[model samples]
Structure formats: C-alpha cells, structure tokens
Target chain A: MSIPVLTPNIAAALAADVYDTIEMPAGAEFTPATGVLKTFFDFSRQGGAIHGRSGGLLFRRDSGFAVIGKGKSLTPYANSIAIAFRGTQTGYDWLSNTNTRTVTIENQTQAHKGFYELFKSMRPAMEQQLNPLLRNNAHAIVHCAGHSLGGALAQLAAIWIKKFYGNKVALYTFGAPRVGLKNFALQAPGSVDATYRCIHGDDPVPLAPVWPYYHAPYNGQVVRLTADTGIRVSSHKMRKVPHCYQNSARGDWANLISRERLQRQVFLKREDHHKVTFSEYWMNQIWDALTTLLRQSGGASAFVFGLQGLGAGVHSFYDNLAIELEKSGMNQQHSVHLEGLLACMLAFAGKRVIRAIELTARFIRWVFRQVLSVLDRAVRQAIQQVK
Target chain B: MWHLQRSTLVCILVGLLALFTHNPAEAGMFGWFKRIDVQVSPEIKGAITLHDKPQADMVIKRGTFFEDSWSWDSTRTDADGHFYFAEKTVKAREVLHERQVAVRLLALDYPTKGDEDLFFRLSSSHNLKSRSSDLLTDGMHCELSAEYTMSYLKSLEYPNMDWHGFQSKCRFLHADKVIVSQAELDAAELEETWRGIHSLLAYITQNASEMDTDDFIRFHVRSSAESGLAMLHKIRELETDIDKLNTLPNFEKKFQHYLNKLNKEDQR
Candidate 1:
C-alpha cells in the first residue's frame, strides 16, 4: 500500500476519512484505501450473538495498516480485511471506558497495565487479521489513525501492528486523548518517527479523565489547528479541516466529519422511541434475556458454534448456569453458598428443567447477591491489599 | 373575629412556620422521596489471565452489558494476579430502569500451561427482584484464531449442525463438539470461495451505478487515498439493503433470500 510521507495534511485527511467512515453505518461495504478497504461483510453478525467486535471493524484505517490475508481456507475477499474501529458515541460506554483506570494488555502484567478498553479490544483483531496479511504480503504496511475516540483506537491499533505484526506501520491520531500509561509511549508499537498526532484548537476532549490517565509522550509530529479553523474533539461535522500550520495538507478535516457522512448514525438513532412496535420491543427484550443468560452460563458457550434466536433458548439457559459454577472462581465462602443454592436448584431441575430456567435466572442472581453481601467486606479488604 | 385572641393567631402562625421549615438534620425533610444509592453486587468477576511461567497477569472487564451494547469498566490484576472491579453503588432510579449488567471476558493471550483462556460471562444487579436483563450468549471469544475462524465460516457454509445437540452440549448435557468434520471444513472453504465470488458480483452491482470503469476501479482500489465518498455510498446502499432484511432469528433466511434474488437477476 502506498502512503504519502507523514505530512500534516496527509495525517488530517486520513483522520478525516476515518471520521467519515465512523459517520457511516457499520458493516457498510466500503473500500477505504485504493488497495485496502476498512470494512467487511460478516454473515455471522446477521443472526449470531452480537460479538460486539463486528461494528468497530468498519471505517478509515491507518493507510498501509490494511490486513490482506488468504488463509489456508480459500475465500480471498473474506480473508482480506483492514482492522478499523468505530468510535463509540459519548455515552455510558465512553464514560465507563475512559474511567476504567487501567487494564493489563497481552504479555504485560503487574506494573505494565495499559489504560482503556476500546483500545485494548482493538488488539486481537489486529493480530489475527494483520498477522496473516503481513505473512502473505511482503510489501504490506499498516497505517493506523482515527478521530476522537477513534484516534485513541488507532494509537493502540498501530501499537499492536508494530509489536506483533512487524515494523511496517504509520500512525496518525486526530483529536485523540492520551491513551494508556505514560510508559506505553516508551515502548509502543511503531516509532514516533512514523507517527503523527493532531488536535484541533480548544478541543476539550483531549483534556479528559484528568490525572491518573496519562498520555505517553507524543514523540512524532504534533500539530494544533489554527484559531481560524478551530474544532472540538467530538466534532463530526463535515467541514474543511484546516491545518494549524501554513504548510499542512490542502484538504479540510471537515470533509471526514461532513453532514452527509453523519447519515451513517441512522442505526444509532435514539429518536425511534415513537416508532417501535410492541412485539418488536418485546422480542428485543427476550433476545437480550437469552443472550445474557448464555454469557453467564459457561466457558463452553464461548467455543460453541452458532445457534441463533428462537432456537436455543432453553438449552442456552442451562448451559450458562452449569458453566458458571464449574469454571468460575466462586471465591471460598461464595462457592459454598452457591453450591448449596445450586444443589437445591439442581433438585428442582431434576423434577423439571423448565422449573430450573426460572430459578437459574432470578433465583441464582438473588442467591449470588446474598452471598456477595456477606463476602463484600472481605473481598474489599483483600482487594485493598493488592491496591 | 376581633374578640378572638391575637395571641392565638400569633401562636398558630409560628407553628406553621416551624412545620414548613423542617429541621435539616431530620433526613433533610424531603429526603425520603429521594432515591438512595443501592449497592450492586457482581454475579461474575470474569478475568482474562495472562501467563508467562513466572507470574500470571489477569485482565478483567467491568461493564453493564446490554442487549446491543456494553458500558465498560476495565481493570488489571495486581502483581499477585488478583483482579476485581470495585462494586458500584448505583442510584435506585438507575436500577429501576434496568435489570442486570454483564461482565464477559476472553484472554488476551494465556501463555501459562493449564491456564487456557476460558470464555466467561457474568452479571451484576442492584434490584435483583425485578429480574431485568438483555444479553445474548454469542461472541465470547468467537473470532479466536485461524482454525476457529475457519471452523466458524464453514459452519455457516454447510449449515447443518445438530442444534439440539449443540444446545445440549452448551447446557453441559453432552461432550464437547470440538471435532469438526474435514468434509464439512472443505465444503465450507468452497462455500467461502463461492461467497467471495458473490461479493465480487455484489461489488460490481453496487459500483455499476457510477457508469464508468475508472471510477469503479478507483472505488474498489483499497489504497488510492482520494476521499472515496462515491465508493462509500455505493457500498452502504447495497449492505444496508441486505441488513434491512437481516434479523436475529432469520439472518440466514434473509441473506439467502437476497442471494436468491440476486442470482435470479443475473439469470435474467
């Protein structure tokens, strides 16, 4: 993949493309770069349990960072992918992610935990998609970037590409807040020479989560938007993006966040409050219930093949319950209490599996709470020691 | 009225004033109406533990999982490999609006032996009696590695697994369904190639609207860095149309229906 030299204009434009892609509906079949596309069409996403990883795969990718792989299994187009992430809206997810303090990334434990979930989640797909692509394409390069939270994701995505997939990545982050610990910058993927970070004037988002949230040193080129063309962090407005410097690219950053592109946010419309039918709403509710039950049930369901809606409700319920008890740590006191309650419930199930379904969802949750209440103080004290 | 004692009127007025200005210490007067912050105990503390022979690092996701979304609160295990999210005390009103929150996890990479990356999911709730939840038991480490990915793609291709058996296996009534048939895998590979062709056809159909081969080539060119607005629209239109027909219960059916329609058009 051919990427122009890491110029301010090029960085801003790439960031804008990502922002533009973010404005489009996820899974929209778009070819991002001339040789690499940012999104893919997954049939599994249509009916399966929402893996939550599907949507973020769409959008403006780091220029050369597009992963093209034809696995041992032939499906040329299916195998070729670019690891792009969607910027989650400014809501509870963003709040929770930003406030999540710190998390341990792959191979790094103890003192090496990085900050942010949205960034962390970008790791696996990047490895899986890019590893094969890098192996297959000798001239391949990973160009990573995003706008706002997308920028944060791009930072981590490029970091992953640099670390595991080899040193062929160019990273450009626009309006991105600090990602990961201060140390992440010290040994992050891709050198600062190949990285460029841009933020618009008075973009309040970059100054978020305050202290304890550290941005690794921005060693690469740093550009701030000029006062005349100032922008905010969450600005997806389609306008001309002006470079802070006189020599930045000719393209406007607004081209990425344009009004027409924002039409992609249709799927996330909260305005559908008046339009939902009763059945549609309840079906949604039931589907949610089944999916939740399945997650809490087991380590087993994680490996199970697809068995979507209206089909595996009853079975998923029991599987979820059985696995929770088996694989979960249950913590000493909590374990005994759970076992007693479960044993009692197992007796009920022996009489009728249907009886267990009601018990498993409601009764088990109640019992779990009762046990944790007794153990909360202990857990707190133990956790405090670690802290 | 005049004969009534002025002293009585003054005393009654004082009493009314005292009652209206209730003491601040007495539960803030209107505090009973105010919702208290109720504690939500976690039902699952799912952790993805990393192993490197010497020490294990665990990663945990603390989030309120919903039907179509998740609000994450991530945490890492300390030097000793202990990880847990601080239990949240949510407002009672917030609890009233929702039922339960989920914590699901998969390993980043489990280098330690015997410490396989176990897919885990858990829920937390404050108002447990209300029984509110919206979780789908899908996507826990679904896009694992190359083999698993292939296995998954092939399953979609062949479309013949014993759902009841798979369900039973999920429910722990049966042994693991780990061994996928070679025939099935091969069939899936072929189907995947067929799908690739189908996608190419769809790509052509979407781009043909532009009526110029150069523009179309530019649209499909993955790396030609022009603002590909036209390309984005064409792709969105085609995919959005299919997504319209796609549903949780009948995704395959809807997809096949459109595929059939496309196939029919080509014959015409």
Candidate 2:
C-alpha cells in the first residue's frame, strides 16, 4: 500500500479549522472582523510554511481591519466572515527563494496627489466592515491563522488593528516575523498588549528583518518547543532530528502542543504581560557605556567620534543583547556592565591613536605659547635700549 | 661682573641646546621672509591717455597771480607706473574696458604724532607707455592725486560682486549721469534675480525626493528657463542703460549692443 499525499484542499481545510474553532460572537459583522483577523492569518500561513508548521493562529481586535492587505482594496460583504488559507509550499518557496530585487526611480512632485487617491479607495470597504461592529461599542475579538506567508501577514494586520482600535484588540502571532519599522513597534496601540510572537528557535522564518533592531511587540515569556525532525533541505539530505521539529508526522503534533502551551501562557499571564519591557529598552546602557569609554580615553572630542562609529553596529549589538537578557532574565545592571566592557574592547585600538595625537598637540602648543611670551619681552627690552 | 658673565655663558649654552633639540626652522635660507612682486599686464596698449585742458584762473593766493591749468584724464596708472590705452581715439569709442592694472607701493610715509601716526601720506605714481595700435586711446584731462589713485586700487581689490562691477561697466558705456544713478539703484536688483535662480536650484536638489516624476521633470524645465531669463534681463538692462549715456563713444555703444543681442539669442 502507498502512503497518501495531503491534498491542497485537505491541507487548507485543516488550516481553516484552526480558525473555525474560535467562536465569533452573535450579531458580529464578519467582514471587518475577518479583515482584521485576515492579517494574522496571512502572516501565519506565510510563517507556518517557512517553519513547516501545520498552521498558525493570529488574534487581534476589529479596528485595524483596513491595514491587513498589501493591496489598496478590501474584500466586500458586510458581516460575512472570510477565512483564506494558502498552502505552505508556496509560502516556503517565497521566503526561501532569495532572488528578489528592488529598483528605485526618481519621484516627481505631482505623484503625491495620486498616492492620496489610492489611499482613499480603500476607505469604503474598511468603513463598511468597521462601522457595524464599532457602532454597538461591543468588544470585538478577531482571530486569524495560517501556515507560512499567513504568519507574517498576521503580524502586520495585528499592528494595524492595534493602531486603529487602541485597547479594543489583542494580537497573537506564531512564528511571525518582526513587523513594522522601529517607530511603529514603539508607538503601536496599547490594545495590542496581548500581542505575542512565539518563535521555535531553529525555525528560520521568524528571524526575518521585520523589526530586527527595535523592540518587538512580544518581549517576554515566549514558550519554547522541541520538535523531532530536523529541517529538510531536500528529501535526500535528511539527518537525525534537530533540536526543534521540522515538518514530520510527529512534528505536527509537537507544533500543536507547543502552540497550546503558548496560548495558555498568554491567557494566564495576559494581565501582567504588559509590564514586560522590550529587550532593546536598554539603549541607554549602550549609550552610557560609550560615553564613559570616551571620557576615560580622550575627552569630549574622542567621545563624539567614537559615538559616530558605534552607529548601526552598536544598535544591533544592543538589540541582540537585550533579547539575550530577556531570555535569561538576567540582571540588567550586569548586562550593562558587560556592554560597557564590550564597547571598551571595540574602541580600545582607535582610542590609543586619538590620545597620542591630542597629547602631542597639547605639549607643542604649551611650549609655543611660552616661547612667544619670552620673545615679546626680549624684543621690548631691545627697543627700549635702542631708544 | 665675573659671576654675571658666567651666568650669561651658562644661559647661552642652555639656549643653544634647546634650539638644537627643537630645530624649529628646519628649512635653511629663505625661510624667514616671503617674496612678492606686482606687475601689470594688458590685453591691449595705449588704453589710457591724459586729458589736458586750459583753465581760466579762478583765485589768487593773497596778492600772487595764480592760474589753475591742471587737467585730468580717464587714464589710470598700473602698479609699475604704466598707463596703457584701450583705443586709438577716445572720441570715437563710446566706452573702454578698464584693463586690470596692478599697482604696488614703492614706499609709505608716516608722520609721527604724540603717540599717534597721521593717516595721510604721499606715494609716487608711474605710467607705462603702450606701443600697440589697439592700446591707443584719446587723452582725457585729469589730475592724478595720490589719494585718488589709492582709492581706485582699493575699490578694484574689493569690488562688490554685484553693484560695483555692474555700476563700473555701466559707467564705462553710458557715461550718462542719469544712467550712472540708475546703475547704482538697480545693481542689487540683478543680484537678487541671480539669488532667486540659485535658490530655486538648491530647493529642487534638497527636496527632490518629495517630488513625483512629473513634478520633478517640470521643476527642472522651469528652473532652467527662469535662470536663463534672469541672466538675459540683467545684461540687457545694463546694455540699454549704457546706450542712454551721452559721454560714451559710438564704438562702445555698438559693441555693447552686439553683446546684448548675443545674450538674448542665447537665452532663447
């Protein structure tokens, strides 16, 4: 007997069930609610395929429905709940292909008007979905789930929902990329405090540069899961299972268990989770360390130059350090001390050269000033004698 | 006295050691003094001539008979005391281009006062003769005062970017008193126009990203046109004002008109 292949429809149905289980309330309009939910679904679908998960779930509130799709238009139908499930293989291909190229052209002044027009077209669909749910002022919960691209999209959608609805929504993204620019992550609405990004360490998809250097929406208490199969590059290159599960018959079960644990943790700690600061919150640690190094090595001028060179590398190091600190729950002061030590090491070589130049110049100026004073006095005496 | 001598010898030895250690003036001879020379070169010769005119006696000193017959010209002295002419006949040319002439101070005299020095001093002036036909010009009557010569050189050295050069060029062509005043009044106007054109270019460069493709293209065309027009208008106004002057020779008027036409066509 031959083993059965999972049909795309069956795969999509299985993926959709992850969403169908969540009970949307009575009289709740599904279009706006689902639109908000779809962002997460899209991200999970995308992320799950990359991580080889059966599926992923996204949860957030209704206000941010408009920002879900990459396109300028939203799907029609008021109160209709739409669940889109794309296959993991396509999602995996898109993430892993790495052949994308971007070209930039000069912008014209008049095109600003056209950009505003595109934004205006999306307003109607968004309003149609939002007006009904928000009219009663009922608390709306939108859940979106998918496997690969869906995961990434889910994070982006959650961001928009948080932005539009404020505290009315919560977001949960599994194996999702870091979303938005640094400022967006910082300013995301407080309603999104329930947002969680769960990453299985060996999963490569979640490590995407969505919001790498800045604080992520999820900061603490990420559930760790172990999987049986190592990541399969091709059918022939399979080795013993890596620490985290790759896609396998047993791996699917493991993924679901880990997800359930994460969901329980999120629900249990939901109230206190808001207190967790992002790992990158210790920017001041790096800043202070660099300043102290500068003062000790050469003074203000050396400090200024050193600060400039610290640039993006320092930012990246700070961000990575913050993550490590958060994972370990280590003392922040110790981490800061460690950061200072690291900065001192990196800046040591350059500081020596700057110090040498400064000392030489100072000594030369001192000697020159003294000689000039003596020369002035001697010239005055000679003139007086001649007179 | 013997002890003083010994101390002086010790001090000299120490000074020599210090000097050898520093070696401040590593470069040998010609290190202490910088040499400079001023010379005058002309595109043409006989560019300037003295104007001599007989004058009636105006006043007598007390009881002495006096007649003032001193005359002056548009001629200017170069650094080496050489005066060159621009045209063979000054009466035929409406304007003459003021050839740049370098002038150097032979000596400066200072009269000492009680803890102060008098600002006024006399300096010798010289003129160089030009041999070329293109350098010859009709003589103008003028007295070369040392103070006036100093003032001329100072004005050239620090010529105002807009007003001074424009006014001088206008004066050279028109020689009309009314146009001279107009030149002074409108000098800043030309400068303002140029500044506006430059400002437009700078704004485009800085904010190019904010502009869309069509807008970016339109802005480029508009800026180009505006700058060309500004330059054209400035030259045209200058030439027209010069044509109105009565003192300018005919040849200068024709030359300025030709240049004005060329600029107009070029702008188009």
Candidate 3:
C-alpha cells in the first residue's frame, strides 16, 4: 500500500484550518475539515499552568485536535490521522517560550525545556484521543502540523508518534522557533519519514533561540517563500499578505523552491564583517562561523551537551565562546574575525563598538542580549497583529 | 408665426444648455433619464445603553453614503434612551450602487470628567437597491461593552471574487449580511476606487498605442500619491489627538517612495 504525499498547498491550507479549532466556540461542531481531512474533532483548551520547576504536568483542558479521515482522493490506507496544535495564546505560553533551558527527553534527546513541558501538559489528552483512533486503524499515516510556537510542540508530538506508534509520520511546521540542540536535530530523519519546514524569508521567529539550538531535519532545507530580504513585523503574519507564509505557500510542492543547506563554511574577512548588512544570510553565516570556532577549540561537546540544563549555562556558553576566540592558539585570524562578528552584531542592534575595548564575557553577553532584544520586540509586535 | 419662432428659439437654447452642462466624455449625456429615486436607508428604531441602563440626552449621528456622496443627520435619544430614524430616499443615477449607513453614539462625561469618547457604532452596507431584510433585526440594541464584530460580503462589481468590503458589526443575528464602521467601509471603497482607476489607466494605455508606458505609469503614480496625501491630511484634520496623527505624514512618505520604486522597476 502506498502512502499519500502531502503537497505544499494542502499542507498550507491544513495548517490554517487547524486555527479554526482555536477560534470557534468550544463544544461547537466544527465545519468539515479541509484538504484530506473529512471529519473533525476538537480538543482545544485555554488554560494550563507551566510546571517548569517540577516535572509533573497538569492542565485544565486540552489545547489541540485530531482529524481522522481518508488520504488525498484515493489511498490504500484505511485511515489517515492529521493532528494539529494551536499556537501561543496565554501569558504562560510566552513565559514558557522565553524559558529556553534544555531538558533531556527519552532516547537522550535534549529538547527545549519550555517546549517539552508544553508537550507534556497536552501529551495525556493527545494520547487519550489518538490511541483509540489508531487502535482501530493500525496502518494510519500520521501527519502532524502547526505554526508559531505550536510548531515546536508539533515537532515533539511527531517524534513521539513515530517512536511509540511505529507509524509513518510526517511533520509540517511554519515559522516555528528552534526546538532542540544538535543531537535532537540529527534524529529527525531516523524518526519522521518526511518533514516540510516552511518559512517566509523575512520571518524573525524562526531565527530565535539562537546558536547551540537548531531546527531539524538538520540539513537546513527550507521551502523559501518569497525573496524578501530584511526582517519586517508584517512578514511574520500568517494571513493573505503577499510575503506571508500563508500567501507564499499557495502552489504545489513540486513547483515550490527550496533553499539547500550552505555546503561550504563561510569565513568572514575584516572588510566583510565591518560592512555587514543585516540579513538572514549574514546571520546564518556568522553563527556557522562561531560554531566552527567553538568546534576547533576541541570543547564543542562540553559546550553543547554538557551545559544542557544548568541555570547559568547560557551565560557560561557565551563567555566560554568569547574566551575560546580570545585564545591565541585558537587562531590568530579567528580572533580578528571574532571582533568583526561582534561589531556587525552590535551594528544590527543599532550600536557601534570599539575594538580597543576588552572582549570580556560581559560585553559579549550584552551584545547577544541587545540582538535578542530586537528580535524579541519584533516577535511581540508580530504576535499582536495575529488577530 | 412669431409665437412658433419664439418656441423654437427656446427649445434650441435648452438643448445648448444641456449639451454644455452634461459632457458625454464625463457624465452621461442623458443622465436625467437614467436617474432613479431609491430607499437607501431603512427606518430604524434603536435604544442606546451603558451597562444595560438607558443612556438619556445623548446625541447620535447617522451618516448615509449613496450615489458616491455622503449626507449627515443627527438625532437625540429621549428620556427613555430610544431614538428613531425614518427611511431615507435618495436619487441614484445607477440602479446598481452601494449604500452605506452608520450611527455614531458618543458617550461623554462618563467614566471620567471631560473625556469624550464614542461608545457604540452600528454600520451596514449593501449594493442592490432593495434592502436586506435582516439588516436591523429586532431593531438595534447597542451595548457599549460588547465586542465589535466585522463581516465580509461579496463584491458588487466582481461577485465571483471572495472577501470584498461592506462588513457590519452590529450585535445581532444575520449581521454578516452588512458592514461594520463607516471609516472601514470608506477605506474598502477607496481600495475599489483605486482598482477602478488602475483599470481605466490600463484601458487607456491599451487603446492609445502611441502612449509611452513609462510616462503613463509615472503620471498615474504621481497622481495617486497626491490624492493619497490629500486623503491623509483630511483624516488628520478629523483626528482629535495630535500625537496619534504624527504617523500619518511618515506613512504617506513611505507610500509615495514605494510607488516611485515600483515605477522604476516597471521602467526596467
């Protein structure tokens, strides 16, 4: 029996349809699902306290839904289940998003502490709804999808469905922030059969929870929608705007354009770093260079994995990265390049830096904070425009 | 014979006056013959309330849009907070024209002293001459605390197209059949007006083979920018808070800059 391939247009439409689960009144019978989904079921709920300190999870209600229906127009499988999670809503979700600490999940895979806890809160409700549906139809092809912060939860859900149910799982996420570290990214291919990571070219949400945290399928193949170069708050909107994700994801997957991973490492020269214009390309290149520099220090493992959940580990990581770059043995040229990268980053935050100033861990951390502050403001502004 | 000559002279003068006043290139030469009087707004009896209590002695204003012109009228609620507006009939040259009507109920000197604010609004629109049966069901019972609702309707010009303007937000069943605020409806109409202008520009360009495409686009872009700036200035005048009006000029400048950039791209 052949499984149906999810096309870009259908996946995009479904990602939008899932929002109806959040908008419509509770206990209201949803209008029939779109695309491949025939019947609808709603498990959406509003409030849940984030139990970050304790591992235990409790929720007043569920926050997503599952649709059991046929695949495409015709398929050999008896049933196909498409599970969708709702995006950030309450203040607690925002709090969870900012709590970027890491936690070890099953199989030693490290996941974002906030996202993992969100998934844990809804896991029981999801299982209660999915188990019976799957039991009746064992060969169901599970498709999990979400947008914004919900996309992070959907990724975690996809991994769980694949690990426990032994089903052919496919994942789709739009404008989702980073979920886990390098090891978690590496496990995507082994778990999910296919992943469709779609992002607008100017969306700022996907650029967050910066280095040491990574998006999965690990290879960085994103369906690049529109060629808009600079970040704009309006670009993150999911509606009918031309450069938005929903608008750009209109055509078939076969016809869509994909930006492949940067194969060769990008090393910045003194001139290149000083004159750097802020763009997604430059941001990725700089982070990649910083990762390479850390690796060359022979402490990549210690920095990436060893400091997984420590409270002050985020500051420690940046400080160590600065210290490593400052070492003469790391590379004479690397130190100059590091200074250039810091200058460019500071410039992006609308600040100028002097090379004569000591490259202390505090200064490096402040630069990161300023850059992240800009991104946080952009994300908040985008979120306000959602309705 | 002198009486017959005099009547003939009068007829010729009338003809000359009509020809000069109604140019075929602009208004239709026989516009009077096509003019029809229609009931553009229905008689509506409404009551205003704040926290479910009657709001007395308040002035309510209703602005009606028909035949591409706006007319305003104001009424005051009686001691019982009840008000009534008789049906409005207006002359429309075309039968298929849009009608928009909205009531502004401003509650002043409550919640804080010297603070005047608009408390509730009820706006609706339809293109067809005949009225929507459910436009004002059970009349209008406007609650100041109720959340605003907006609904989309099919386009009058392009019915096949999805999500055209004329949204209504009055709290009642079948509210989707009408529109919300007059300001929003006007904005939507402005979009359609621009769309029409662009279509006319395209038609003219297509027929006039000798016209330079760059020059034509440049002219339209400049005209649009000027018109948009005028509209923004008018809005700023109507706006009360000078601080909030600061963004208008900057927005217009960006809009003009963007249009210029587009013109340049087209030239390429």
Write down the lDDT of every candidate, Cα atoms only: 0.35, 0.27, 0.54
Q: Worst ten-residue run, lDDT, model 2 chain A? A: A103-112
List DockQ for all candidates: 0.02, 0.00, 0.01
Name the best candidate (by lDDT): 3
Residue B186 C-alpha lDDT in model 3: 52
Q: Per-residue CA lDDT of candidate 2, range A123-177, in tens?
A: 3544354454445533333433233334444434344444554313433344443
For model 1, how does the per-residue alpha-carbon lDDT over B1-268 read when each residue is reduced to its tens digit?
6557787898898886675334211212232255655434333322222222212465544445432244666666556444455545456432111123334444444535445442443332222111111112211212222121111111122233211001110111111233235454444333333334344444444443442334223233222111122223233334434543243224233334444544565476
The TM-scores of chain A alone, one per candidate, are: 0.44, 0.35, 0.82
State the DockQ, from 0 to 1, for candidate 1: 0.02
| Candidate 3 residue-wise lDDT, B128-190, digit = tens | 232342354336666655554433433333332223222222354444554334564455444
What tens-digit string does per-residue lDDT give for candidate 2 at B144-180?
A: 2212211111112113211111101001221231112
> What does fnat come to for each candidate?
0.02, 0.00, 0.00
* For model 3 chain A, the run of ten residues with the poorest summed lDDT: A46-55
Superposed by TM-score, candidate 1 places the C-alpha of residue A9 at a distance from the truth, in angstroms, of 4.9
TM-score of 2: 0.24
Question: Candidate 1: interface RMSD in Å?
Answer: 19.9
> What's every prediction's RMSD, in angstroms?
27.2, 34.4, 25.5
Off by over 4 Å in 1: A1-13, A18-28, A32-83, A90-98, A106-116, A120-124, A136-138, A189-193, A218-220, A228-387, B1-268
